[model samples]
Target: MTRVCFELRIKPELLDEYVARHSPVWPEMLAEIAAAGRRNYSLFVAEGGRLIGYYETDDDTAAQAYLTASPIAARWEAEMSRFFVGLEARPDEAATPLTEIFHLADQLAAASTTSAEGDAL
Candidate 1:
């Protein structure tokens, strides 16, 4: 699986609405997302309307293409675009993912062991 991350800006005033809408994602939309090959998807928001999205997919290109080509995606994007800013076209087509700099699960555990063992010695 591949990890994907993207950043977008939401309207400050619409943040509550945005969050509310996602609180109970539409069953059909969720189903479409899954059918498009996305898994473990999540979205995070920060003050001033910064939005971050993350997901794991078997193939990012295929997943995105599948979603964007679907009529459900078009409908969803039309509703969601009202809450966003700086999109060239629509939410579905405008996403530009960020490059991953580092990942530290095993690395952190291994590095911490050296410090813990040295303290005992």
Candidate 2:
């Protein structure tokens, strides 16, 4: 389960409309994502009109190829491009990968320890 995260700059005024459009994402688009092995997808908005999207995928290449080849996804991207910047050639534009430093989960009763003294201390 590889997790991916990226940011998109959205127009502040279009935030509401963007949320509304995504309230019930197109079934076909969801199907395409699932078909491509994408799971646990989510999006969030932060101050300064930054949109953060996250998802877990088994194969990034497959997921990306599926998205690029799916007509529904392509159309959706084009439609939503208006609400974002740097999306002029989107669907072709690649999403940047974020580095993962640490993760905490409720399933772990005891936290995993890490050496802080720089020598397995």
Candidate 3:
């Protein structure tokens, strides 16, 4: 599985609306994502309206092709551009990918288990 992560900025004032819309994401959009070989997708919001999106995919190229060919994705991007800045003016209307230095999920889980055991003693 390949892990992907990226950051994008959204207008603070539009956060509420954005969250509401995402509460029940379009079915077709979800289907498109799945068809693209993406899994365990998640998004996190940070200070200053920065949005961090992460996902694991078996085939990144296939996922990209699926997304680019999806009509639902295109429409969603157009609607979402209103709440984004750089994307609105960019040719692709998509966020740039970020480099990942470290991912320590297993190590963190082991540390948490160790801490719990110590607390019980």
Question: lDDT tens digits, residues 9-120, model 1?
Answer: 9999999999999989888899999999999999999999999999989998998899888888789888899999878788867876899877696579877998899999
Estimate TM-scores for all models.
Answer: 0.83, 0.79, 0.78
Tell me the whole-model lDDT of each prediction, alpha carbons only: 0.89, 0.77, 0.80
lDDT tens readout by residue for model 3, 1-121: 8998888887899888877888988998888888888899998887677888889998888888777777888887777778775674431237768898777996799899999999999
TM-score of 2: 0.79
Model 2 segments beyond 4 Å from truth? 105-121
Cα error, residue 84 of model 1, in Å, equals 0.6
Instruction: Output the number of the lDDT-best candidate.
Output: 1
Task: Tell me, by TM-score, which candidate is best.
Answer: 1
Selected candidate, larger lDDT, 1 vs 2: 1
Best first by lDDT, ranked: 1, 3, 2
Cα error, candidate 1, residue 7 (Å): 0.3
Q: Give lDDT for model 3.
A: 0.80
Residue 17 alpha-carbon offset, candidate 2, angstroms: 0.5
Scanning candidate 1 in windows of ten residues, the lowest lDDT window is 101-110
